[model samples]
Target: MRYAQVYFLFLVSLGMVGCETTPKVDNPVLGPPPPRLKSALKQQKLKHAEIASRANDRKNILEGDFEDSENPFETPVITASTTSAESAVEDTEDILSDSTVVAMVNGTPLFVSDVIGVYNFQLKQAEQRMPPEEYQKLRRALVKRDLKGHVERQLLIHEMKSTLKKEQLDQLQEVLETAFEEERIPELQKGLGVNSPQEVEAKLNEQGRSLYSERELFLKQQSAIQFMAVKAKATSKFSREEVLARYKANIKDYEVPSKVRWQRIRITYAKHGGKDQAVGLLDEVIHKLQAGEEFGVLAKKYSDGTRAEKNGQWGWTRRGSLAEPEIEEALFTLPIGQTSQVFETSTSFQIVKVNDRKEAGHIPFADVQGKLEQSMINEARMKATKEILEELHAKAVIETMFDLDEDDVNSTNSAGP
Candidate 1:
């Protein structure tokens, strides 16, 4: 049988034979078995024969033999003891082989080995930290993710080949190869802490990569990037009116809250023995401030607040953000460069100085025009890139080992640069 047919038969046999068992009667008088018992025995026999045949076919397939013999339905008589261990080994070898295709893009195959080779270092790390079952699950997820990326890259390359002239592609390839050798190699050596080309190759080998593969990958990425750059530039230009419209649509993002930068002196009741002592300490601090001594210096010398070590400097705080309502009110109401009169909260005696203040308002368009324009251009470029990929996906023939619904296909196509 063909491999797929054998697999289907094996599944059907398992469902029939594995689940059914012969039943015993209380006062049985049996010469031959009952009709139901006979049927069950026959099915059990067929299941074993099918399993043995499938195993033999699997062995042949692994050895690259697909030709039919004189008797195509012939089943090799397999001894249970010998075939069990041998079949297990063949099954494992089949799974581990590199020739299995996981996906195809425009008829170009992506093999199991390709996914494993590209991400071997990451897989090794995950294997070290996870149990065998968990590691297997993670490996499947990583392979799926890698296959999507590989398919997209293949699609892009296909688009480039179809759209670009052969002469232009040849010239671009030459330029990119020259750049890789002259510029990228030296930078790569420095980044990898290697001094020579051979050393760089050795380092990459340890990570399941090689110099040739690295260069090929770099070329592919740069080709796609350059192509996308040209396409995006053609579509990305935005008028001043468009930028202004985008900014107005997102105007709430530009509103700045009222805030103040202030300093404080706090004398907690617990730190100063009692409320009376705390009040007395605050009076001394006030006297020093009144005599032209610096508030920060007075705070450092006497305050028991958490920021005392930093001269009790409270950095710019937005309005109504403080837990203490009394302190919050005092911070915003105080004039710039002036200290508030001493006030008492339930836990402490406090004084504050406002260093600066900004009223609640929107940032003016003139101040952010250049940034807004650049941001709008970048957004347009991204949208253009997405559209290009979507168009390519619609045109290309994509097949994968796993099934994808429409939503999944759309999501894969819409993945950003």
Candidate 2:
């Protein structure tokens, strides 16, 4: 599957499996927050200034206002500075009182509340399941990961909004809303086991979501998907000759390995009490086989292996794939439609019957041509999509708290005492 298709499916699944809402706490007379919370708050405030500074620095570097370093490979170290204790406290207090802006995509601000809202249920579960330190760590990691996705999504959305006319956008939105109501709502109703649209709405409300919000999300996603699909289709094209060349270059990958379909009656030494008892039991099994009892029936009654329930059938194994060297050797050499004498391995005693075998061979190009061509097209689509995203990133002004935090850490480490 293409990345965009997989991502679109993921979003759809999330919308279908809505998050459980966490109830807000309404306690009074709380003491100071934990050290981790304090640190996170401080970092959040610091990132705002640091991101702007880095943006200006990058702009200056591009404009040749900053001189080139003597060693081009070496990083230009950033000097660190200290903040006043009183100012740091004030910043922390402000963050506690107001929603911190965690990221910016173009001119749009993504608040910390917005980022957390996406994963509120998951974070709540983590807090209950993990220790405070571990939960804090996981929370940071989730934020960083989701923040990247949010940035990319916003970039795509911005591209879609900019590229389409207002009327065209409105038409697209109308089509999506209609489809959601006609197709998606029905599916959601059946999946949720609800009989009415009101029940579906109520269920979504229980998950801190509304039908309007879900519809809006659907509209934005469908627009982005349509834009990417159109872009990818325009760029991804391959000829028969190109596909054939790729096939010939990677012919070994298309080669089929030798395989066998065989059966066995395994008698583990431990299962029968010991090696001596196992040997005795094997003797009885061989006697029954010689008297012409059905091997499958006997295997079902006595075999201790994984396929014992399936009449000891080891269906279609490739050469060199089996861990049991003794069985693997016997598998290829044993004649078809015949049973072998009792064989002993370190852990077990076993007898085998070979049913069928296939020789190693290369797949014909004519047989796999269509699939190969499709695969090549998918690859090209992915590459085209990547290039489109890169172009978008170049044109868009994106800043995230995690990026600033990393920059601040690097600068601090570089500016040693």
Candidate 3:
């Protein structure tokens, strides 16, 4: 039962996983468990038989849907190096006091301190390149999120295993391990230039030493995705109203920026002789403007820019956009119906005639409906994921003796570099 309990704990701890936007790498932000938890955890005393009994009793004890026990002080099987029970008990008490108990599934406790340990470790790693404040906040938020994800996955796995055939679970585990080792591990190793088993082992040990987090976060994330997909298929389906409601709720994200149209003529100093030829060309362009020749027509004939095809029309100019600073400054300054003298640049001599200008503004909603609707759908998917996790947390069986304050438990402090 103690081995079973330990195994269950291992599985539960493994269930918490971070988002998988990229490759599976060890997180440097999570350090080893606080010395107290590590020591007490090492000193676990409960027998394998007791834990086995608990696992068997789960069906009978947690009968109702969404039911969970409130007390978390259930005795754990400790296996510390020490033989003195008194020393182990004292160590456990100290660990519980400083630690934060978050949620308990069945009689197992999930400590806030444990989550923070991982979060801080990740934050420290990010701080190598990012500003301390920015990375810390990001790490803290991600840690809490991943912790919730972990707990929900544990509950889901327990429920699933209750019905899964022994052969089926074994087969799935084998497949998962093989996929990770044969496909993911090799790919990651190759990318990192770790060509040998010795090199891979050395790298993992080195990273684990500095960060104190196991490489298991990657496996947990993959497992969670699989479990979620199963749950979604068996439970509920997406609907139109849900989509529309989400779209409406986040409508502001859809607006577009206004644009302006204008025309210009450029004479390159590189093409003509130098300052003298540029000046002569500018004078001729000014003379053409006085003669009432069309600016676009002259630009099409003499302008050195690719925009000459559009009759020197730069389709739209948005404020603070990506145009050349000199061009932008000169364009915004020229009055309508005025022609400018030669503006010398390292590349060209330019004469700009302002045909017209339009002040920038927001784009109307109707004009951007398609983009807005897509954005809404993405937001809805994220919200749906969150709602599912919240639901799982609400119904989970949990217990804990960690003495963290409520504020500390809920606080979102930056983890610091």
**lDDT by residue for model 1 over 1-417, one digit each (tens)?**
212332333233323422113223431112122133224334444555566557765676665533445785564433333455345444332232245566656656667677666777777788798866577667666666677666667777766565554555676677677777877788879999999999999998888778898798778777776666654444455677877898899999999999999988888999879998777777788788989999899888888857989898988899878998877887888779998887878888888899999999999988888899888778778778777767776655566665444543553322222
Could you arrange the candidates by TM-score from highest to lowest? Answer: 1, 2, 3
Candidate 3: Cα lDDT at 95? 25
Model 2 spans > 4 angstroms off: 1-98, 113-116, 121-139, 234-245, 265-313, 321-327, 341-351, 362-374, 404-417
**Model 3, span 87-196: residue lDDT tens:** 53443332221144444543345555545554443445776877544654565455446565455566566544543445546655665565565666676578558886
Taking all chains together, each candidate's TM-score versus the true structure is 0.72, 0.61, 0.43
lDDT of 3 at 92: 32
Better of 1 and 3 by lDDT: 1
Task: Compare candidates 1 and 3 on TM-score and give the better one.
Answer: 1
Point out the worst 10-residue segment of candidate 2 by lDDT: 408-417
Q: Which pairs of residues collide in candidate 2?
A: none
- Between candidates 2 and 3, the lDDT winner: 2
When 2 and 3 are scored with TM-score, the better candidate is: 2
What would the TM-score be for candidate 1 when compared with the true structure? Answer: 0.72
